[model samples]
Target: MVLEGLGKSLRDVLGRVNSSSVIDEDLIKDVARELQRALLQADVNVQLVLELTNRIQDRALHEEPPAGRSPKDHVNKIIYEELVGLLDNGEGLELKPQTIMMVGLYGQGKTTSTGKLANYFVKKGFTVGLIGADVYRPAALDQLKQLGEKVNAEVYGEPGEKDAAKIVKNGLSKLSGKKIIIIDTSGRHALEDDLIQELKDIAAVAKPQERILVLDSQVGQQAGPQAEAFHNAVGVTGVILTKMDGTAKGGGALSAVAKTKARIVFIGTGEHIRDLEPFDADRFISRLLGMGDLASLVQIAKEEIGEDEAFEKVAKNMLSGKFTLTDMYQQMQAMTKMGTLQKVMSMIPGMSKMEDKIDYDASQAKLSKYKVILDSMTVNEKDEPTLIKGKRIDRIAAGAGVTGHDVRELLKQYNQSKKMMGSIGKDRKMRKKMMKQMAGMDPNALQDME
Candidate 1:
């Protein structure tokens, strides 16, 4: 539903096909139409989307899929491949101790992403230092210090250094222990001469190994020009898109990668130190198309379901719609294996800002209550939601050690799950759309799963 409009467009084009049969030009055109519409809706540059779709159409009509693949399957796979090809290839930075600079406009997550980047390097076994070169901003130094403390990285800044260049020069001079030194620069609301001069001066001082522009994913189409503007001024080597856990207008970041001739090196899914991930284009666009990011899911599962039994339990439940609160509780616990709820929420686009309004501690406590309720029920009752009637509800309430209302809430959630699965199963349009989404899956892995 998040991609409601784009969903309609995709269904309109891809919905016509139902089997593994060969497709015609009409079908390809329709699929291209839907892709064009979805990309535009996602705030992709109009010219780029058109060009991309044109290539898709040509490939669908001209190229042959692998053996036994259906026409729809062929097109779906082709689109996935071409889309990745359209995105600029990811470039790896030289794995040496060197200076890296963060450049962006105000409110673009420059400082936040810098800290995350530093944390990323530290985990990768690099000693990293931070030079708070944003002396223009009143609170930049303190903010970087607080962030540095979280990552246990060194922060270099004096109490009242007014010149950004001076702070960077001093920071670099004293830098001894770390291989990578990240200089976080200040930004203005728009491109201004003073800020530009200061950035140039910092670059001259640091002679950075790489200068990365931190672009906000929410900026959509505007990301391209903004990236170009910075690239023109400071000559960015790579870009990092942040706030990827929110309603990320994904097209913008993709466009930024395309427009600036700069590769995306990392993405910021959360505000936490470990929230940054190295760029992987195929997985990223797959999720953008509402197909799900299985790689990310696999990462989560590896951490949460370290036990084979636990992994199998949730995977079976997810595919069969037999999920329960106990199951959900285990899933929640699995999620916690990675980090706190607040940190996890920041990784999911729609779930961002959840802690801002939701009662986090209470919500976790509710999960615990539901866990107890499920534990009280017979295994059969846990499997079948419809079987939990009044007497069972009371027994479960007493067993879970919560109010009867709590049992009702658990049933409510289960009902919601059933309704959603049923809707996904019954809708002809949804089936066709989901089939196209199957393109994102690794055919070998899926076959193995089957």
Candidate 2:
């Protein structure tokens, strides 16, 4: 969650709008002012913030609600659109085979971003090859190689080589078979002449289809000038903002780069190798405003679960209200594969609004304890949890190195999940309606669910 503070502020203001009895001039103005405050506090440029707030205010006050749409829903729609307008407008990169060269200043997580980019392509079923053309920084090649290994991509690096252009030329020849070839170029402390020259030379030899400039979101307002400089030097086609998950200044970086010629193509959401996500302004803003991104969630679920019969069976069992502890454990493993609970929740249709209320850290620890408890149960106990009571609970607790209370807690959670799933599964109309709502959801429509 990038710019979480700003998101919380915006959601709170929207919550007020929904609860208000009247949507009038004063309420619109108040919402505008609160939005300005939130964006400014998140390090968005003052001019951009004013411009965005102005648009939101004008639209909300003047635009008539669509037929059957309430004034509150209309205002929320205006806010969602205006906020999305503040970011990238260009079509993102194509998934076909292409050469991509990564460039940026040192310490901007450029090397790590290379790995992330490679992972993104690999997940798309591309055969990725990483070229470690970064020669200046000590261990830069080693780091790239390690990341390449993590993503299972081929790496071509000439260690101790001084000429970056020559290394890229040779590496391109070596890794030409890969569908996606990403060259990680050298970086400097600042936008220096030497670094620019090196990038130019590498681009000349590589003729990369995409020259992506990586920037640290924490760079704040400086991200604009940096992007301009790189784009001028090597015709940077796109930008990747890193460290977005932990930075308040991500809004600044995002807004500033959107002003530049190089539009954001990807964003590094976290430290994990798989945290890089394709930048979609609509989806990004939807998640930010506590409206879920079901498209991205489904994509992640597909990548994690695929067509596993075991998972399908577990899901069916859960829906039938006949799932065992073993089935519950399988479901937990699938969720873990998708992402952190907070991230998964943010992608659900209406769960993002509950993110702040839940204690995810405690919940994650509890899940771990439950896994240990499940591991200690006998096969029969796992299949029929109701059978484990009294003495049985005590024996399982001792086996799991915990008190009987812990075992009971696990059962309580399982039963709750089973009950909820059963209710949803039994109601065919409710399930179909939910699926329809998710399949063709408007941003304003999210408010109804919330």
Candidate 3:
């Protein structure tokens, strides 16, 4: 959600382009100016902003739209491509066996990101080991130990050990069984000589395949110089932008780091341990432009649900025109695991554009009540909702500690959902059409299905 203002501005500019009857030089220049303004407001470097806007203007005026594609669409596509170019395009760090050393200034969330990186590999079936080489910071080793427990990874640290390189050397031998090893080195309030030398010593002992610099997005364009300093010292291979959820200067950090040798490999989106995500510039831009990021959404669902079979079964049952209350309850549970309704919707292409129209709080409240009501019901009642007559409703409400009216409201919702799903399920032609559309849906038009 960083750079939300920039995203909104970009979307509005694109909307103007969509509304225009014709693509003219004036419109292109205007769009370019608006983009410059937005980028500047987001704390992007002025020089980079000018360069990007100039490229957009040039491409829009000279480039021809592809066959059957409207001029407006071509311009939009150009904008998307150009915007993506302003960020790292390299594939994220590979998932194979590797040792990674985390380096950054103090308070940049280096240790937290180390855990997140380890968690990422752990989820991918890698055996991870964390080395706490940060000897200067009090409780740093303890923090790493706790995070290691959270991710089910082993942590190696030596209490009262002043020599970081020696600790890393011992940790490597101790956690040699781990397929992936991540070393967390000490950080300073600023990148000083001692911190640089300490990192070099640790790197020498660890011989890591990757050195990651965790930069805070709030630092804005200053991230570039800091990243460069780390890269110069010990060859930082990748960067992780932290605190991206609410930073207005994230745009600056992103653009600045893109110019550095160390490309962005991940972004810390929230406080949750699972909120760290691999950074993909294209998908990121898609979301920023209000075009959604279905790939990321699917990835989140896979991570939360842990099985594609569950999704397939739900789809099949929904389309069969007959699904039990248990099925509905399970579906709701899945949604809850996926994330907030607002977050889920924002990933669904044009749905981000409809954020203002949605009553997310009301929807979340209703969902909670529905879940509680469903929980209060008997297994048989859940499987067969028709059994829930007057007495059953009263019993369920009392069990849930809600009014009977709330219980009935839930049933009404279930019936409405059943009717809607049934309409599509009972109609073979409609079902076929939906399947076909989903299989070949244009990424940009994905929200039409909603």
Candidate No. with top lDDT: 3
lDDT of 2 by residue, 1-450 (tens): 566777778777777787899999999999999998988787777888898899999999889987756688678778877877777568788989999999899988888999988988998899999998888976998999999999989999988989999999999999989999999988888889988999999999999999988888887767667887888889878888888777454766766566665678988867889777678776577667654322223323333335344444545665566777887887666554433545545544334333444565565566677778888998998888889899999988999999999898778767655555555535433443332221212223434444
User: After aligning candidate 1 to the native by TM-score, how far in Å is the CA of 210 from where it should be?
Assistant: 1.3
Candidate lDDT (C-alpha), each: 0.68, 0.75, 0.76
What is the C-alpha lDDT profile of model 1 across 1-450, one tens digit per residue? 233444345434444443325578876787688788778987888888988999988888888866655566566666766876876466556677888999999989999988998887888899889989887788988999999998889999976778889888889888867788999999988878888888899898788878899988778777888888888878988888887766554677777878877888887877787777677565444444434222233333343334344544554555576666555555545443433544433333233222254455665665555556777888777666689888888888887678888788777766654444434445534332222221111122323222
TM-score of each: 0.65, 0.65, 0.67
Q: For residue 417, give model 3's deviation from the true position in Å.
A: 9.0
Evaluated against the true structure, the overall lDDT of model 1 is 0.68
* TM-score result, candidate 1: 0.65
Per-residue C-alpha lDDT of model 3 across residues 313-336, encoded as one tens digit per residue: 555666577878887776666555
**Worst-scoring 10-residue span by lDDT in model 1:** 435-444
The best candidate in terms of TM-score: 3
Q: Looking at candidate 3, what is the lDDT of residue 331?
A: 61
